[model samples]
Structures are given as structure tokens and as C-alpha cells.
Target: MPSPAAPPPPVVTPFTGQFGLAYPIICAPMFLVSSASLVIRAGNAGGMGAFPALNYRPLERIREAIRQIREESAAPFAINIIMQKSNRDRYRHLELALEEEIPLIITSLGHPGEAIRLAHQGKCRVYCDVVGLDHARKVADLGADGLVAVSYGAGGHAGTLTPFALIPLLARHFPLPVVAAGGIVDGAGLAAALCLGASAAYMGTRFIASCEAEVTSTYKAAVVAAGCHDIVNTDRVDGYPGNFIRTPALDALGLEPSLVERILSGSRTARRSLARIRATRVLFGAGSSRATYKTVFSAGQCAGLIDDIPSVQQIIEETIRHYHAIKGTLP
Candidate 1:
């Protein structure tokens, strides 16, 4: 027989078909890390790429970034938006995304009903990131096209439950597609998510080590050098729980801001904005900070899987290859 017809390849799910992606992977829209180059490269490599809308300033820059991605690659990409009250410019970013006619929108930190409505009006798909079943049900009722189960061990404002528990919980209840996030760094993780009934995987920490990522050499080096034990979860940054590599600088930061500090901040929007600025400065080296690289670094438990920094294309291709290789060995 003619090679058994190559086993007919894997069945394409609704996610891959609807988005026209070759693989069921989404490069999480990591703030300050996922840049235009990373997004374009990931898309060209047959997986969906994304970046945070807040990464760009003045709105026009984001428009230009979108234009550049479209001009350079035909693969689908997404823009992430913080939907909470702190993101004062959420609607402004949404309007810009709609104007650009972007392919996908990922909403986090708040309700998705308004976003789902506006995205649908613009013919774009909206996927909300949820930490638990209640959040999943809320987003589903709001007509979210998909749900990203942000489980424990994820980087940058991670959830509380483990993927083993979170993915199936959402899959069992929600009728829409589910994307598994948190601690997913390689093809094996992707395969596990699929086995759990998730249609795709959303990965952020792994991409920080990508050649296309906007992270510095110090950040990349830290991720490569660290292991799961080095990862720490704290609420000091942004007033919410987030994962990061343990360091002296991180240790020195307070676990949570004081109640008086919260009250004196005038408004919720102002407090959130200020918190973000502080976090960026202390952790990401966004402003004048010389010790950012050595003293602070954000990462997930998946750092254990990253051994080398590779190009986006190489990463995606190798991941898919490994997935097939692993699947071939199974009955």
C-alpha cells in the first residue's frame, strides 16, 4: 500500500479551520514581550501570533504595527486588550482594532459582552481568558468565540487552579472552543491540552526566549538558567497574582499595597495605571533602570523546558514535529 496514505494527517478542528492556522497554537499576547516581529514570524510559521494593544502608544503606532503584520504575513494574528476598569483605553483600542479589521481579539481581566458585540460587528472573533468555571460561564453566555483557561503556573497574572483541573472543567461546561494556558511550553504540553478536550494551547513564557521576542538578553538568559523552583508567585506587581523568577529585587517588594495607598489613589483607573507603571519600571526595565535584567525577571514554571533561544519559525516547526513524533508512539 502507498505508505498507508500517510495516515491522513490529523483532523483539523474548528479552531484551525476557522482561523486558517496550520497548528492549534496561539502565542499569548504578552505585554512588552510579544512584539510585531514575533507576531509576524509566528503567523508565518503556521501558528497564531499576538501582541498586547497597550504595548503601543498614541494608537497610531498600533495601527501601523497591524498594517505591517498584514503586509508581511498572510497568517492570522490577534490583538489583546485588558477589559478591566483599569484599562481606560479599552474601548479606544477596540475601535482601533475594528478599524484595522484585525482577525482576532483576546480579552482579559473583565467581562467580554461589550467586546464580543463590538468584535462581532467588525467580523472578528473574540476569545476571553478565564481563571475558573464561573468566569468561563459568564464569557460563554456573552457569546465569546473561545475561552483561554489561564491555569496555575502561568506567567503574568496567572490563575489559581492547575491545567489538569481547569481545562476539563471548562471543556465539560462550555460549548465553545477552549484554549489551555499556563505551564505549556512544548509539544507535549500541547498534546496534553488536546487530550483534555482543549482545541488549542496558549503559551506566553516559552516565547520570551524566542529570537523574535522584544525581551533583552538578560531576560532570556534568566529564563534559560532557571527551573520550576526558581519561579515565584506574588501579588506585588499590578496588585494581582503573577509569576516571576525569584530575585532579591522581587523579594524586597511588598506582597500587597496598603489599604491607605489604595484609597489615596483618587480613582480606580488612576490607581491601576500607576500600578502598571510601577510594575513596568521595576520589573520590565521600561524606564530608566539599570539593574532590571539581573534583579527582576518575569517567567512561568515552564522555564524548565526552555534550553535555548530559537527563532519563532524553528520553535513552531520543532514543536509540531515533536507533537507528531510523540503521537506516533501512542496507540
Candidate 2:
């Protein structure tokens, strides 16, 4: 129960390499959870905070979120979009980002071409999340300004690539800015990410447990209690391979590991099997595992390293201290 150690390095990631934010940190955009307050707080604290556009209710709610963030903070922030889920209103979201001249926008779960076009014309940067070199290359060619490399431990539709391997590979040939995501918790990890040739560190679990984040107390506690091993990357919940803490609710369901693997791999039966499980038995499956719905809780492997629920400012201060300590040791 000792407090987490002081940060071990001093880092000043260049702001203009990709994201125009002061520090090379981007809060991962959580669907249904990221709020204007949280995003503004992170941006004001010198990191980029993101809210997925899908979280908005009325189309006007999206503009209100953007307006509020701009009113409260001067630092850069981003809006995340589930490109695959974008409907007729996608243009509306992009239109507002353009009219407001937002700093950054990241597109996930789909293509970034149209959004990227809008972002570029408005002088804003467009970022896309990719699981591997192929997708990484595709996004870059789409004229996306950069990529959020979603490797192992990332919350949604994640891939099992090690940062050591993936970062280096993407850094080598991707030809665009790269934000390394997954397993990034404290300053040490952030410092390591920069060392791995990333321009920034995109974090989800760290923000999910924040005081300002719009997560349920039960979900936040689950994050504080989980370690790297606690999260299960499964297809039982959503069709994607997301990470979450293994709860008794999930365990009560007598699903096998092979089935979970098949679905996570995008096997055709994955979606159908999950639908049947949700419809047939109530208690057999845990919270939100049906094909139509998703589990309320999604955690990152970083949960293991984070034990305390610190404020946004506290985290930034501690991270800055670590950035310095690591810099002090460098030649």
C-alpha cells in the first residue's frame, strides 16, 4: 500500500511532431464514458483528452461538448470517432470540428479518409488507431496525419503485439506520427514509450480511473483492484477483442476459452454464438456479454501497475517528475 514512487525522468516531447499538444500524451477516448470535464481537465493539464463522438446523444450534443471544452481550456484536445459506426451525422461532427477549428481528431474502428480530409483542410490533425503494420500503412496512405498503435493491453478490439516489436516496426516504415498505446501507466512507461520512438503515449485505463472520468464507482474500483493478469481479452462481449477484468459475473457463464478465442479472431460464428448465449441464459453469461450489447467494464493491462486513484493534476505532476528523473540519467 505504499504510494507509487516519484517519476524517474524529465521529458519534453515535441508538440508539433504529430499532435499539437504540449506534452506527448493523449487520453484514450472511451466510448460512453469520456466527458467534457475530463477532456478539458486533461487538456488544461497539458495532455490531449478525447471524447468519442458516438457518446453524444442528439447531434447537437456533440457541438455542445466541443463548445464547452473550448470554453474551458486553451490547450489542444481531440474527438474520437468510430468510423465504422458513422452515419449521416458524421459530416455534422466533422463540420463542427472544422467550424470550431479543433486541435486534433482520431478515427477508430473504421476508415479515416473523409475525416482526414476535413481535418487537413481545417489545419487540424487526423489520427487513426491501428493494430498492425498493414493497417498502419493503410491509414497513413489515407492521408491520416498519424496513428494510435493499439497493441496488447489496449481496451478495445486490441491486437497482441508487443510494444517493443510493434513500435519499432511502425516507427521504421509507417511514415506518419505514431502514438504508442497499451500498458502505459506511469511516467516510467511514458518515458519508455518515447524511447521506443513514439511521439506520444495514448492511455485509456489511466483516464478511466480518474476522478473526473464518467465511470461508475464499481467500474473504477474494479480498475484499482485489477492487475495485468486480471483483464480477459475476449469476444464474448462485443465482436471485438477488448480487455476487461475477470469478474464473477463473467465466470458464472460456462464459456470455454477456445470459443472466446474464435470470436476474438473475427470468426463468423463469434457474433452468432454470442447472440445465442445472451438470449438463452440470463445467469450463465455475465454482465453485458450478449452480441447486441457489451460489458460495462473494459480495462487495460496497465490496471495492474496503477493501485491508487489520483487526480488529473497529481498524475501530470508525478509524470513530469519522472520525465525529469529519466532525463537526468540520460547522457
Candidate 3:
């Protein structure tokens, strides 16, 4: 009779067990928006946070950031690395991660064989960003610790499949934990993700509007103001389809790949070169912060769901509370 034994807590995800997370949520890494400050805040708040290594230059900064996170919080966090050959810093970043013995490494855009191997040696885990079943199969065979199913509504390099379609597919086909990433911005989305067989929800765009995000105020405001219709996919950013909030600058660049882009994309090397070219022009050309805000603001359809710029702690607390509320209502 002792308070009915408190009704035993509902199981959130296998992800929590894998990493000792208090909640099954990941603040997905955003290229320029994610910062060490964000990671620290999210980690201390009981959710895992990740930042791209590309966000830091001089390479040593990656080492410093990892150490800083460890000093500030005991919670788990991850470093995201673009593993393609085009990323000259990929190998060095991977070495840094291994040397630091970071808790997690998230690989995107290439094979994760080496990452998985090295991470295992260091007692760390590797999660690969996979958009399809074929790619998922490859990484699973390579001994990936988990899979991040990047669906069509995802902010950055999005996939063609919806969360409903991709999450179940990956969950059914692989024994590895599946984390759903897309237009997931709130507790309801988190609940739905778990119901769809995902072990956790990988949320990116929603965190861009957080108080800890280092992005420009203009960018954060844009995300709060935009909606699902305001989001569009364009291949001009990295020669890969990425979701971004529509702005006059983006519209001027058009959504389709140019004839040269199409023609040169016949080989992997050519595609990488073209991606660098376009990224330089569109992503890096805006020299001033204000100019960049007007040009390229990456966001997902989830922008519609995020109306406030709350602190990272508040966001995590609310999401979990709401998740429990929703779970309780289910028969």
C-alpha cells in the first residue's frame, strides 16, 4: 500500500540506458549554431548535446571544448564530424575525439568503419547519421553503436523519408538504437518518436532558438517567426538537399542545381568540389554577420512549433513533463 509503489516510471528509451541519459533527447548538432555553451547547458540539464567539430577552427579548439564540457557537466555529449573526403579536418577531428576519449562521436556523409573501430578501442560509442535503409545497413554492419534517422523535415542535410516511414524502417531492420530526427520540436513529437520505435528524438532546429545558442539574434527570431510553409529544400548549400528558411537571398540563388553543377556531379570527387564551390559562394560569401542572417538561415519545418526562446534547461524540463503528460493519457 506504500503509495502504490509510485507506479514505476515509464520506459523512455534504450538510448537512456546506453548513455545514462536522464531523458531520451539529443540536441542535434547544428553547424554554426551549436556552441560549447549550448552543449554544457544541455548536458547539465539531463539531455545529450552535440556540436560539429567544423564549428571550431585551429583544431585544438575541439580538444579544449571537449575538456571544457567534461569539467562543467558529468552528463553525456557528442561531437559531430563530416566524414567525407571533402572535409580536410575530418581525420584530425576524429583523432582529437579519440585522444580525448569523448563520450560519443557522430559521423555523417561517409563510412564510419574507422570511427567505430577507434571509438570502441577507447570505450566510446559511435552513432552514424543515416538517411536510408541501405546506408543504415552499411553502418550497422560496421558496428555502429546507433543510428540517427534524418528524415525529410530535418534542417540540415535532410533525407527523403518522413519520420513515420524512416524510424520504423530502421528500427525494424536493425538491432541498433534508432533516434528520429526531423520536424520534432516538442514533447508530443518525442512521444510520437518513441511510439514509432525510436529510442530517442534527435532535435536540431528547435534548439537553434534556445537561449544558449550562439547564432545571431536575427537568426533566432527568424526561426521563431517561420512556419512549415516557410521552409524549403535546396541543393545549393553543399550540393546536397538541405532545409532552410526561405529568404530573399536564398530565393535569388534559386533552388535547383545549376547546369554546371548537374554536369559536374557525375563523380564523387566532382560532386565534392562542386559542393565546396557552392558553399563558399552561398554559405561563406556573406562576410558580415548581419548579411549572413539575411542570406542563409538553416531551419526545419519544426520552426512552426517553436514560438519561444527558452533557456536550454527550461526546454528540457518542459519537454519531459509534457512527454509524461501525453504518455499518461494513452490507454
Candidate 4:
């Protein structure tokens, strides 16, 4: 994509206006990839950036990271909280977010009822990540401010529907703003998403290759070199189906969990314990096993669209330029 010769046109929508973003993009939160610097850069660049609360361990780091971003930049940023029963710290994470008066909270994997209530009380907004209309309706009914339609080809645990199908479905059924997530990486994608009734584009895979991402260079290279075919869905990583690049490290993990592993994963409690074990291995580990775990990087099929490692600002600016250029040619 070429750089813009002139200033990009305003692409503001209700989502961007409400979130104080100049661009209709959200750097979707990733488990290990999203960092404070990435969030700050994305926000300062006129797009919202987020990181999972679990990314910072010991809990206090979450507060510190929030404060660090607040001190350094005035851009809007979000903290993701996995509301599943397994995330024992979800309450505390949400508590701290509300206590700090964070602007937005992204909830995933569980009902966001409590999060919505508390966040609204704290004068913040809650956006639930939904893969289908069923979940979208539920969250909307729960008074969620917006919906993040996580369509197929998304990096993490994605839904089965495509953005074309999911985005319109939610927009038609709910009055709230919808942010389309999935295989959106460029201005064409951002333009198409808005045309499909999305207020913003929720991007993850593209940013994984950004200079701000903290992943290993090998992981970044894999993302840059990969195509749609190189991306595969695997449940062995953490007992949930998430798309990942098929690297030698991912191949070594095997195709699926063992029989006993499968049975244990069937239980919520066991799944939680297993997730903690995986988190431990990934975040702080020593030995070859740890090295292998580190390679289990999550990415979307949109990795095929990303060829270069650019700064977060460059990505946003180029995307906005592309979007304007495309919008100009539209009928």
C-alpha cells in the first residue's frame, strides 16, 4: 500500500466518537503479544489498543501499567478481562479497572453481566466479544455498550461465522455499535467492514507483526511469511480452538490433546488448572519445554495480508490512507 499524499478523510463513527478515537480501529488484545507500549502507541496513533489483564501477573502490574499509560499518553486504551469461571482473578482485574476509572473494558469467554453493571457505575463502557448472534443478543440485553464481532479467521478463540455474516446480523438485531474482528488487516478490509455495518475494525494479526509487538523475532517472521493456509486451528494449546501458525514448534505439540488430557479438559475446574499450567510454562519457564511453549503464538488468517513490520502509527496512518483512497472510488 502507498502512503497518502494528502490528509486522510475523517472516518469517525459512533464507536470512534464514543471511545475518543480518530480512527475506527481497535488493536485487539492478545494474551502475550499486547504490552503497555503497544497499547500506548496504538492509542496515541488515534486507534484504541488493548491488552489482556492476564498479561500482567501479580495483579499489581495491571494497575501500574494502566497508570503508566495514563501518565505517558491521553489516548483511549482498554483492558481485557476474560470473564470465564476459570479466571479466578477476573473479579479483581475488573475491580482494579473500575477503581482506576479505565474508559473501556473488553470482556470475553463468559457472561459480562457484572462487568457491565460495575463498569457503567464507574462511568466506563463494556464491550463484549461475541462470535455469533446468540452471544451478541445476550450481551446487548445485558446492557453492553458495544459488541466486538469476533468472526472466523480471528487469531484467538474465534467464532465460526465470517465478518460479512456476523457484523450485519448483530447490527440488524441490536442498536449498539458493532466492531468487526477477524481477517481485517488493511484499509480495504476496514472499508469493507464499515460497509458491512461495522462501526470500527477490531484488528489483531496485523499488529502482531508491528514493531511494537513484544513477541520473539522468529514469531514475527513466521507471521510475516505465513499465508491463510499456514494458519490452522488447534485445541491442544489450551483446550480451546484458536488459530495459530503451523510452525515446527506448533507441530511438536501434536494434533490434539491425549485421551486423559481431553477428559480432564472437559471439566471446568480441570480446564482452569490446565490453563494456569500453560500460562506458567509460557510466562516463566526454563528448559526446552519452555522454549517450545513460547513458540505457540496465536495469529489470524489475516497474517497473509501483513508483509512488513511497521510501527503502530505507520500501520494506522497507512490503513487510514488506504481506507480513504478506497472510499473515494466507491459508488
Candidate 5:
């Protein structure tokens, strides 16, 4: 008998068909930085861009901002509902997204029961940022459409799991989409995420310094200037450990290694130890990179990967090209 016909190749559908994207890149909902304009721009570029809802604490502004995004872009956008108990007030912000019928919602700092329920009601998609395999399981079980696997060296209050370890574990257990976040800055970085089985890549620090971002020029300059070893993975006082560039702020606190250990161990709350995080923001509003200097500015160790300050569009294009180039290497 003739050899059996070779089995037809499995279909390779574009990832965007499900997520509704032109690209698999996402602009991370950075705290105090992601603007409605910026969010829409990313979406228009064939990807998702997000804003932290807390930035619009005032209900009226929140509604207005949501309306602006709806009016300005038909592309999909997201709002970040912080997952911290301390940010209970942010729940009201979550209500704004639901009320406006936002399409994409990213839950961070906590469980997604509320976000998932709200999104399902609106026929929206929900994603969550997680630090490890356990949180990944929780996000998936809670009915998120996707999980942003935040691994070691992620900016801000992030987790310690390595991307190599976290991605495969999630790929094996979760059927939903996985977006890798952590120390990813270039096109090569984007390629690696896809190769590792992530459906997308979420970025923050690189965009934080962009002209489209709301932070000061001085802060943007600092991001361009810093090198990798300058960063510190500190848990000195924040309830969760996060990465930041070491600066005078950390040194001035005079924290002993033992004290750092206590905070990281969860025996002591950062509320008592690092009471200055809030006060220091006063400096941020005042445009003093000085206070944030020698102090931890929430940045990933990938600072080494970033050099010149580029527009968000430029970063997106460069990364997209690299993603495709890497795909070409797969065969």
C-alpha cells in the first residue's frame, strides 16, 4: 500500500485573533505614568496599553478618562486595578472601568475574583500580574483571560521567580494566555517570551522614561544613564520585595541587613519601616530626581538594555521587528 498521506500540519493561527491585537506587545499600566492618550496610542499600534486606575482617584476624572479612551480609539485598552489591600480605595476605580464597559482589565497586587466577575459581566477580558507559579494558578483559577508572569528583576513591587522557570510551569498548567513581564526591554527580549510560550510581552520601565509618559525629564534622563549593577533587589520596607536603583534614599534609611531580612520575611510591615515612600513622592511631584536619586526608582535590572530615550512607538516597532526575526529562526 502507498505510504499513508503525511498528516496535515497543525494550524498556526495568529495570536491576535483571540486577544484582538496587531502585535503581542503590551504597555504595562505603570503607576502615575500611563495616560489615557498613551494607552490609546499603544492600542492603536495593534497592541494593548494600560493605565493604573488609581491615577484617576477622582471618580469624575476616571469617568472622563475612560470616555476619552473610548472616543479616541476603537482599539482595545486596559485599566490596572491594583491588587493590594492597602489600595481598597482603588476598588471604586475598578467600578469606573466596569461602568464604562472597558474591554481589557489588568488586576495587580491581589486576587481577580472581583475583576474577573466585573469583566465577565461586561464581556471584557481580565488579566492579572503574578510573581510566581502559585499566583499564576490563582489567576487562572479565578478566571482571568491571561496572566502577566512577573519574574525576578521586574520593576516596582515584583516577584523573585525566574522567567525560565515560571513560564514553562504556567504553560503546562494554564490553558489561557500568558504575558511575560520582567527585565524585558528589546526586540530580542520580546522574541524570547514567545519562544518560552508566552502569548505576549508586557513592558513598563522602558516606557516609563518615554516622552509619552508623565514622569519628569530628569527621571527619564536617569533611566538612560543607569547601568545594570546599580540596581538593588530590596525588601527593606515595602510589604512586597521590589527592584529599584540604589540611591541616597536607601542609604539614608540606615537599614541593617537584619532589618532588611525582617521586612522581607513579612514579620514587619513596610508601613512602619519605610514610612517615607509616600513623603518621597512629594519630591517626585516637585520634579526632584534628587530625592529618587541614590534612592530606589522602580526600574528593572534591564536598565542596561535601555540607552536613548525613544518614543513609545519606536520602542514598539523595534521590538515587533525583533519578535518576527526570532520567529524566522524557529524553523
Candidate 6:
């Protein structure tokens, strides 16, 4: 008998064309989780993969990671840089990103004009993460190529507004492509984001459960076991709101740092450094003694959708397949 016809591909928008990707999906540059191997695999799967610049220490290692990704896959990838003044290595990493001529730069935490300018000079695209309409407008005015609407239920450093609200707000105000983030773990969420006016979906928490992610099996277990309600928003991590699985380590944090405590921590650099150390120990180190996992795991509300650990290729392919299935049923 003749072979049955293959299913039609997911709808391709300008985002897919601009980034040379088969799907309008971008792997979020999640710190610690977004490893070089993960990025390479995502790119090979016809999606734009990304890794946080701070994931590599000594700065030079970032360039090496970028080179490794380039050598492994011809597909485009992105590098994320925290634009806060407290990030002492921000400028150094930016320099390396420009020198390497990275394809995309994802900026978060603060204004990204300098990074945008440098990325533009290297003929690279800049996508800034914004939680609100005001921030979106500012980044657009600063010449950002795109905006990542990091809405409520995101894993780390999340915003208050839901994707439904933030995506439309930014899309209406700016002509740049809008990438929806937060609580997008499966194909249905991806399709919903597109329907809400996002050109692409930027997923982080779901990718954490992928095999290629540089995380412990324990971390993956926590993610797999979690649901939307299990995720908690706490500002004790780094003065910004972040979603994390509530564990003994998190409870021990007591409460958010007071203004006096923040001031007493010293200057901006000192406070940032101290916060980084504390965060590293609590989240990545052994602090959560009571739970099955000992790390402070971060996950989006979409954790409910993550039932098993899968390969990056599997995740992307399944997401696209489900997306098409959902689209076919739509009017």
C-alpha cells in the first residue's frame, strides 16, 4: 500500500523566517540550565537555542561555548546578558558577544541600549525582556529587534502580568516581534501564545526538564513532581520576584530583605555579589535538606504539563506536532 501523507507543518511566521528556524520557538537562555549542548541540540532541531552569558565563568569560556555551538550546528543561537549595573561582568561579556558576532543577544534586568548598539554594530539582533508595557516601549525606542514578554508564572525573575495581558500590550504598542514567555510548557500553550499575537514562544521552565539541560536528576525530579500551585513567588532570591518550588531552604529564607537590609549589604556591587553567592548556595548547593531534592528549583506554572524528562529534539518535535493538531481543529 502507498504511504500515508505526512502531516502539514506548523504555521511559520516572520519570526521563523528571520531566524531561519522551522518553528517560531526560542529556547530561553536559562542560567545554569541552558548549557552549550542544550543550545546545540535545540538549534539542530530547527529552533533558536540560547544560553545565559553568565553561565560561563572567566568570560572567555562564553566565547568558547559560542564557538562550540557554531561548530556543532549551523543554526542560529542567542546569548543572554543581564543588563543590570550590578552585573560586574556584563560589559566584558558584551564585548565577547560582539567579538564573536553572535546571532542574537537577549538582554534582561535593565535598559539595553549599549548592548543593542554593540549587537547592531555586529549585525546581530537584540531582544529585550520586559514585564510591562512601559518597559516594552522603552526597549522598542532603544532599537531592540524584539521583545520577550516575560509575564506571570515565569520561572526566574518573573513579572506580575499574565502572558495574555502582556503580549497584547506590547504587540499593540511596538511593531517589533513579540515573544511570549512564562507558563508555556506544552504545545497548547505555544499555540495560545501565537493566537495572542506573539510571533514566537520563549520557553524556559519546560526546557529544564529536558535531558540536555545541565541540571541534576534531583532537579528534574522536582520539576516533574511540581504543579502550578506548587510554584511560589518569592523576592528573597535577588530582590526581584522569582518563582521556585517551596522547600525548607526557601522557608528558611524567612522573608524578603527589607530596605534597611538591602542598604546594609553595602554598595550595588557588593549587594549583587552577596546575593549571587547566597542564591548559588540555596538553589544550586545543598540547602533543602528535608525534600527529596536539595536544591532551590525554579519552574513556571506550566510545571503541571511536564510529566517526564525528554530530549530537546523530542520536546520541540512534539510541541510542533501538537501545535499543528490544535490548529487543524480551529475554525
- Residues 65-174, candidate 4, lDDT per residue (tens digit)? 98889887898888999898657788999999999888889999877999999998877899999988788888988999999998888998888998889999999999
Please, what is the TM-score per model? 0.87, 0.84, 0.90, 0.90, 0.84, 0.88
* lDDT tens per residue, model 1, 1-331: 4552122133356789888888888888887788888999988878899998988887899988988898999988999998876677889999988888788899988677888998888788999999999888888888899999999999888999999999999989988889999888777888889999899888888899988888789889888988899998876655567888887677767545678766857788876766666555643346664333335677899998899999887787777777878788877
Report lDDT per candidate.
Answer: 0.82, 0.74, 0.84, 0.86, 0.72, 0.82
Q: Residue 126 error for model 6, in Å?
A: 0.4
Give the TM-score (vs. native) of candidate 1: 0.87
For residue 225, give model 2's deviation from the true position in Å: 0.7
Predicted model with the maximum lDDT: 4
Task: Give the clash total for candidate 2.
Answer: 14
lDDT of 3 by residue, 164-213 (tens): 99999999999989999998888899999999999988889989998989
| lDDT (C-alpha) at residue 65 in model 4 | 90
Candidate 5 accuracy as lDDT: 0.72
The list of candidate 1 runs beyond 4 A from truth reads: 1-11, 254-295
* Model 3 TM-score, all chains together: 0.90
State the local distance difference test value for candidate 3. Answer: 0.84
The model with the greater lDDT, 1 or 3, is 3
Candidate ranking (lDDT, best to worst): 4, 3, 1, 6, 2, 5
Tens-digit lDDT track of model 6 for 62-171: 87888899899999989999887657778897888888888888999867999998888777899999999888888888899999999999988899998888998888
